[model samples]
Structure formats: structure tokens, C-alpha cells
Target: MSPTVLPAACEVLVIGAGPAGSACARTLAQAGREVLLVDQHEFPREKVCGDGLIPDAHAALRALGVYDEVMDRAFRAQHVRCVAPRGGHVDVPGTLAVLPRRELDDIVCRAAREAGARFAAPWRFVAPLLDGERVVGARLKGPDGEHEVQARWVVLATGASVPPLVAAGVCERRAPSGVALRGYVHHPELAQTLRELQIVWHPRLSGGYGWIFPGPGGVFNVGAGLTGSHATEAGGRASMRDVNLRQMLEAFASVHAPAAELLERGELRGDWKGAPLRCSLGGARWSRPGLLVTGEAAGSTYAFSGEGIGKALETGLLAAAALLEGGDDAAVRARHEAALAGLKPRFALYEKASHVNHRPWLADLVVWRARRSPRILRRMSAVLEERQNPGRLLSWRGITKLMFE
Candidate 1:
């Protein structure tokens, strides 16, 4: 069979119309590049997420030019409830935003379109169209027919989805090495009670926390994640859902009656979307080619917080800037790596701290200590807010002062 012919040309072709993809397309298009953004699903597509935009994410949205809309449509809050079974609580207050992925992605896509990006949603990426050794574009299969798009550059923002090129072996898909499950739920009490995001820690789900983020109307987003190693060691004898949620409720119920009741009555919104957590600070081996993978596809998520939105936005911005630098793929890659360097150590430490958190008792103790001490709570809040790195707490002086003073 004859191969499909490539489109005349374009400067950039972006796969996946999520936050990272649309951000890249918008940036490239604003720079006068002929950009084509494609996604398998149409507008208002649903994405599995906590649906809460951390404070850092709010800043990123502003830079992406949709802060106003996001603010208008999102749930405004000022604190995160950290409930750990070890028996203490930490309440850190700061401005945060929550909006369903549907609305958030739609707003970003529309902004990309308004910025001159041509979008082709409901278009499946069949494969990457390579020019010699360089990734030039992609072969897309849509309702109309199969077509090839040739471009000077390609941005793979397919998130967890394997891009055709990656699936075809031209690039490697970095497996999470850790598994996670996220879902939505609805309950009037959960909705009214959850004025802010809640993070519940249980001993059964070490290295992962169950999260409940309020959604539109009276719904809530709830989910859990656990390291694959821990999950396996837990015997693989039963399901994580039962083990984790049970642990979650036990730790949260008495202190948070509303949360407990919501769990008892709330309907799990949709099918659980399970995926692996990619904690690759070394970046992807295949990302150095003309093709670049941003967001979770590149494993840029912070292992500790599961906060990918900010890093994804930052990576997309870096990709756009690197492309504008007029350098080869290696040059673009170096810049990308350098951009993420500052965030690597903090993420690594987060992962370490997170693992120690398996003992909800320990987490509760720390939270309890923090609650009793205002200064400690302030410092901890600073760490959670990303104002101070957790690794900084490793210093002897810092550790002693935090514990004693």
C-alpha cells in the first residue's frame, strides 16, 4: 500500500489539545508560526484530574491569558485541609482555584484558536511523519479521511496517551513505575462541607494520598495514588480501592464528619481512570529529537504533590521558547532540561518525604505538632505553598529550629 502524502507544510503540529498542547500552540501561533493542534476528543472533553488549580497553576493560567475566565468559572478557596491518620491537622490558607477539566481545557483551546491556532479535534494521530531522521509532522485519521501533516516541529502533549510515534517505537513511553486512580463523586454534604481541597492520608496507602476537590454545583472530585512497589508489597491479594478508601475514611471521619458522610453516600462519578505516575527528572530519552513531549508524557509531574498543571504549562512555555530560538533538537532539549533543573531537587525531596508519609500516624503527629505551634504551621505552610523548598528543611539548623522553636 502507498503511504499517505504529507500536507504542504506547517511550522508546528501539536498533538493533544489539553493544557500543555494548547499552550504550546497558542505560543507558537502568536509567534507567527502556522500551527495545527489536534485532539482525539472534541471540545468540552472530560479529563481525569483533581480539578483544583493550585496557586501556582493560577499564575500559569494568567501567563497563558485565561486567568480571568478561569477565575470566573472556578471555585474560589483559600486553604487545603491535610488530614493524616497519625493524628494532627495542618491547615494552610492561600488563594486557590478549582474548575472542571472540561471547562478549563475548553477555555485554553478557545484561547489557542483565538491566537491563530487551527484546531482539528476528534482527529486521531495515526503516526508521526518523519523527514529523514527528524520528526516533521503526523499522520492523522479523522472523519474526513487519513491525512499527513508536515511541519518543521512537533509537540507531543498527548499527556498519558501514547502518541503514535511513541507507540510505533520511534520514541519510548516512560512507564509510571507507580500507579494512580482518580474519580469524581457527587454529594450535597461533601459539596457544602468541602469549602476547600482535602488531602487524606492513610497507612494502607503509603506514598499516596486520597484527594477530594469540589467541582461545579455540588459534586466533588476524589481519587488515590500509590507507588507500584508499595502496591505490590501490599500483596496484590486484593483491590487498592477498597484498601485505600477504607483507610481514608477511618482517618477522616470523626474529625471531618461531613467528609465521612459524603464518602458513605456520594456516588463515584465515573469509571476510575488509572494511570502511572511518571517521575522522570532525567527527562525522556527520545525527547531530544525534532519531536518534544511535554507535560505528563515527559514525566514532568512533581512526584510529591501530583501537581502537573504548573510544570506542564512551564514546559510548554519552554518548548515554545526553544523552538523560537532557532536551534536544533539538541539545543531545544538542553533548554528544556535546564528549565526543569530548578524543580528537580524539590520534587525528589518531595518523593522522599512522601514515602515516609506512609505512616499516617507520623503524618498526623507532624500535623498535630504544627497545629500546636503557630510558627511551625507557618513554616510548613510556606513549604506547602512552594514558597520554601522541603529540602531546605533537611539542614540541621533548620530541622532543629523547626522541631524545637
Candidate 2:
């Protein structure tokens, strides 16, 4: 009998070394899959973010075996102090931990490497290698020119870089809604209040809010998020929106929270970096044939509070599990979607309620009442902690009464 040669290709090829990609690669490699993880940057890369992790995020990291390690290095935020534009403060119950995304990404990537995944950094993925009509792997370009990797499965964790794939007719972005600008800053004076994460809801900024998160040593991460449509609506007056954010935080610190000076000396690390937030509101495809996009690349970030890290980890884990099952491309897609079906309503509700043109009054009222009522504050915290859905706390009926009725 003729000798048979087993295939030499990898079991999985994961692109992007961010939390989602690294988490998926680590999970799959731990399960004994031959995984190759690739990224455009080397370890310790920085990502613009709020730098605070919700309780749910902690739970997700626990499953990946790096939760305890990361938490040890993280600064714990035990309360969420919120400032309102109408002159009130609310301290929501619960704890949010702070750790720079750079540290978190490196930890997760190292975990994946320890679990037997091959690492390919500083290699930009130029395109997916197509076998006729099927995606077999990817082609990457870097200092060494170009190289192709072959794998049974390809997972795209390339947050917001989805346009290149869409242009190549590999993936599609739907309900394309908004853009988000995020940057990192260092403020030493913000240390004493590092125990709490502050979110400011300014009425002047209709669809966006400001955040002040404390990392290790009281370094504050201050940023503002607004919808792209809102920016366009401002018609070159968008700078005024951020201006409102700055002025509001200054006033709040001077009177309500003396720690507001954390933001007073806020310095922009660089020009605001933004990415399009594609919404997966109902009927969005999770995967197609040979490729699967997870995390923000898949539009999995929660639309309401703009939470993505936890959901990205969850979806990444699920995507890895599906690829490990050893099925055809169609079967892999089915498993991925089924795993995420439970979260559809959460994503849908957030996308619906968080529109730039809708429900600003209702949202403000909710925040206002929560500031006045401790019970409401706790409920809001619970919702953010993902102990229960926010829907359970304020129903459509209650929201109506709170705002209008």
C-alpha cells in the first residue's frame, strides 16, 4: 500500500493579538489544537480604552486562567462615581478593576504562547489566502516581505479593520452606525479616587459621555465617546462637544468631587484615534464559510455602555470551541452563532436605545433618578456588573414614567 502523508497545515490561524484573538488562541491551544497567532504589533502593544474592567470581564478572564494574575497587577475600583450635568452625584455599588489594555493584551498573549500556540508578531495580515472560493489561510506582509500560512480554520479578530475584508468580498459590515474616538492620558492627581470609576453624563453631549478611569498609581484615563452622526450633526463644531466634557468635569471637581482635578491636567496622549462601531442588530452574520470574525470586528460590543472586552472574550472563547470541534466550515459557523444567540437581545437593546437622536431625555432622567435614589443606584450598578440585565431594573413602562408619563 502507498504511504499516506497527513496534512501539514495548522489546525487554526488567528489574526490580531488583542484580547479577543489572544483569548481565542489561548483557549484553543490549551485544548491541544495546533494554533498560530498573528498580529501587526509586538507584545506590550497599546490600545486606546477606558482601562477599567467590569465584574463580568473579571469572570471571563477567570475562565482563561489569567484572571488572578492580571487582577494582582490591576488597581481595584470598588465604586462607580457618576456626575450628572444637572448638579448631582451618584456612587453606584460594585467594583471595577483598572489595568492598561497593553498589560492585559500581553498577559493574554503570553498565556496563549504558554499553551502551545505559535506567535507571529509585527506581521501585517494583507489578505486571506483563498482556495478558489474558500478561505484557506492568510497572507501577511512585513519587514520580510510576504508569507502565506495555511490552516484548517481562520479567525479574524482584527477590530475595526473589517473594511479591507469587506472590500475584498470576504465579510460584510451591516447597520453601519457610528464612530468612537478614544485616547489614553496620565494624571497623577487622580490616585486618591482610583477606587471608583467615574462616568459623566453631560446633557450638552446628546449621544455621548465622558469617562475617567484610574489605573495603577492613580494615573487617570480620560476620554469621551460620541456617535459619528452626532459629530457630523455638529458640522465642524464637534470640538465644542469635547469642550463641554472638559468644562463639565472641571465644574464637578471644583464643587462636588474635589478629585476632579484628575481631569483638569488631562493631556491627550495623541490625536484621538477612532474606529467605526458596526452594529450587529438582528440578522447580522456571525461567520461565513471558512472565516470567523470575533470581537469588535464582529460588531459584538454592547451598544449601550460601549462594553466590548468581556463580550469579545466570550465570543472568542466560543469561536475557538467551535473550531476545535473538527467540523466543516458550515458547521463551525452554526456552532459560533448558536453560542452567541443568547446575547442577541442584549446587543439589540443597547443598539436601539443608544441612538444619537433617540432617548437622550429618557436616559438623562434615569441617570438623574439614580443619583437621587440609592436603590436605583444599586440597580444600575448591578446592571453594569451584568448580574442582571438593565432591562430588569427599568422597564419600558418605568422608563416612560421616568421621562414623560
What TM-score does candidate 2 reach? Answer: 0.84
Q: Write the per-residue lDDT of candidate 2 for residues 302-395, one digit (tens) a residue.
A: 6666667888787888888888886777888888878878678877666655652234445557777786677677777777777665654455
Each prediction's TM-score versus the true structure:
0.86, 0.84
lDDT of 1 at 112: 91
**Would you list the C-alpha lDDT of every candidate in the order shown?**
0.70, 0.69
Pick the lDDT winner. 1
Q: How accurate is candidate 2 locally (lDDT)?
A: 0.69
Q: Which ten residues in a row have the lowest lDDT in candidate 2?
A: 1-10
Clashing pairs in 1: 86-360, 86-361, 86-364, 87-364, 88-364, 88-368, 184-269
Cα error of candidate 2 at position 8, Å: 8.2
List CA RMSD, all candidates: 4.5, 5.8
**Per-residue C-alpha lDDT of model 1 across residues 245-307, encoded as one tens digit per residue:** 345344444445555676678786677676655554433543646687776676666666676
Q: Which portions of model 1 miss their true places by more than 4 Å?
A: 1-8, 163-165, 168-174, 228-257, 280-283, 394-405
Error of 1 at 214 (Å): 1.7
